[model samples]
Target: MSGERARILVVDDEKVIRDSCTRILTTEGHIIKSAENGNIGLEVFREFHPDLVLVDLKMPGKSGMDVLEEIESIDPNVVQIVITGYATVSSAVDAMKRGAYDFIPKPFTPEEILLIVGRGLEKRRLLLESEALKVEHERIRRNMISLVSHELRAPLAATVQYLEVILGGMAGEIPSEAKEMIVRCDIRLQEMLELLRKWLNLATFDSPKMAEHFQDISLSDIATESIELMKSLAEEKKISLILETSKDLPPIKGSKVSLEEIFNNLISNAIKYNKAGGWVKVILYGREEEVWVEISDNGSGIDEEHLSRIFDEFYRVDGRRNAPIKGSGLGLSIVKKMVDAHGGMIDVESKFGEGTTFRIGFPKFFQRQKEG
Candidate 1:
């Protein structure tokens, strides 16, 4: 009657009420199911899966309020209308609170009931349409990200390689001045490439697919490799890299590459922001159900105001001291996404100008768990 016919369930203790609703809705081409009480209504709901439900209060056993609450948990999308003899302001308020779209008083005219039912059906239709639009928008966004990243990656990577070749003296010995310029260009281009990669990683990440790749991995080993990879950068800034791990730690379920990226991004940031001769410490151990990794650095710690947004994409502290530090601002964002995909938790603690510590906990691998 609203737009298209919908499956409707009518639940009431009185035979006349249920028959009346079924006859009215059925004549409008809607399919109908009738239940005598709240218990029967819930049973029919699970199997019939109606798009709308008309529930009556003052039942002998299970009350309509109980039905509304249970239906909300089962499927809040289904339009719910309460039929009540009490019909007091308090009763209506209580029904709405339990997820009723509207209430029809006892002995209502056929026209009044029809009007309420029509409005409920329209509301359900709009809600469904809104949900569909949101899903579509997300799909389009993901596609656009993939297309742009793929288009830019190849050309940018080639330009960086060509610059590296020249800097390596393959193009012929160049003047010292020209060499310095090419080196700077190479560095900037590389940073752009890194940004794009991280951005693509964040946008295209598939949590379900990631879970498929999960395997028992040692966090200590991943941290060690990341430390090794970042050694030269730490050396340039004269920052000391230290690793302290408890032995015989339990394995964590995760994709090795994803886990490695988490450690690398955090460790690199620590070194980049640290003052000369500062120390970056990585500590790993096992707690009750989680394998924990803590990366702490004696550096220019983040401000209190910026901590909340530190994981936001393209967000930076913008402090004068950090002006020289270059990043895509997507590193922490990507780290957080990957950790969530692994069913892990991440937290940060910092005191401005003092230091910062990032703690991540990965669920310990168990035999019953097949995927993340």
Candidate 2:
């Protein structure tokens, strides 16, 4: 029905029915995979990952219902259609409730089968598109929050500092315990202010103007400075910070500020998430035409599932786990965006309870620089 040709899986105990359905679908320019039993159908499902599954209701070993359950468990997005000669009203309704896209009665015409399969494929496409849009909308919303948070930081910092000055007797003397309470207020205010600043920086990078300001910058200098600046914070946590860089590395065309921000956020995160007496090692090297910078920390590693989504704005796994680490969760997101803006890529390798490593690559030459 759509411009996209679909892959279809036809599973039935009867070879004649299976071949007939496969032949019809194949003639319609659809890629078809066939299985004569429910067990083999599940294996084919995993391997083919078809756009639509046509399951016979009553197969040996595993019924269509059982196979449908397994498919739903593996990937809920797959559109399934129940094919049955025993298509009583109850059976049809039961199949629909069990996540079948539609129920097809057996001894059906080729036209009937084709119509059902086409509609199922269309539904699958719509579902996938909807899911993609949902993710995009969520990402945009998070980016907006990150941007607004950043914009709020400067004013917040000024307000907090002025309040601190007033409480510190710069303007007038305050009561003793009142001063203690004000001090606590100032601490919380400062923490909020820091979070706001991080959000603001994250937001700024999202802007086209800020994203465009990238050029060739020395990786070694950036790495060294970032590590040095974070040394104190790591020391406070009793974490050892180490830097290992290849001497005279090739310069990458990227925003110095963005690179600085990237490294600063990464190192800060490493220190923030690390256990006491842990170690953070930053290594910089060049391979062929690309420069690589990797930051590794002996902190609590993120789960494999989370590593893929950690770059999403405000995605905080630790916070979800009720860990004490304080952050706005925009750091990794910003890092990813900035690196992408610079025509680069970033990856994470981590193991739970051991540690995490964030590796980012930069191209030696940026297309934007050549254009300019």
Highest TM-score scorer? 1
CA lDDT of each prediction against the hidden true structure: 0.89, 0.85
The digit string of per-residue lDDT tens for model 1 on 1-372 reads 276989999999999999899888888889999999889999999999988999997898999999999999998888999998988989989999989999999998879988899999999998888888999999999788967676788788988889988988999999999999999888878878888888888888887777886898988899989999999999999999999999998889889999999999999999988899899999999999989999999999999999999999888887353578877789999999998888788999999888999999888963334441
Candidate 1 Cα outliers beyond 4 Å, as residue runs: 1-112, 166-177, 319-322, 366-372
TM for every model, in the order presented, reads 0.73, 0.57
Candidate 1, residue 111: the lDDT equals 90
- Compared with the true structure, the alpha-carbon lDDT of candidate 2 equals 0.85
Residue 255 lDDT in candidate 1: 90
Model 1: which ten-residue window has the lowest total lDDT? 363-372
Clash number for each model:
0, 5
Model 1 lDDT on a 0 to 1 scale: 0.89
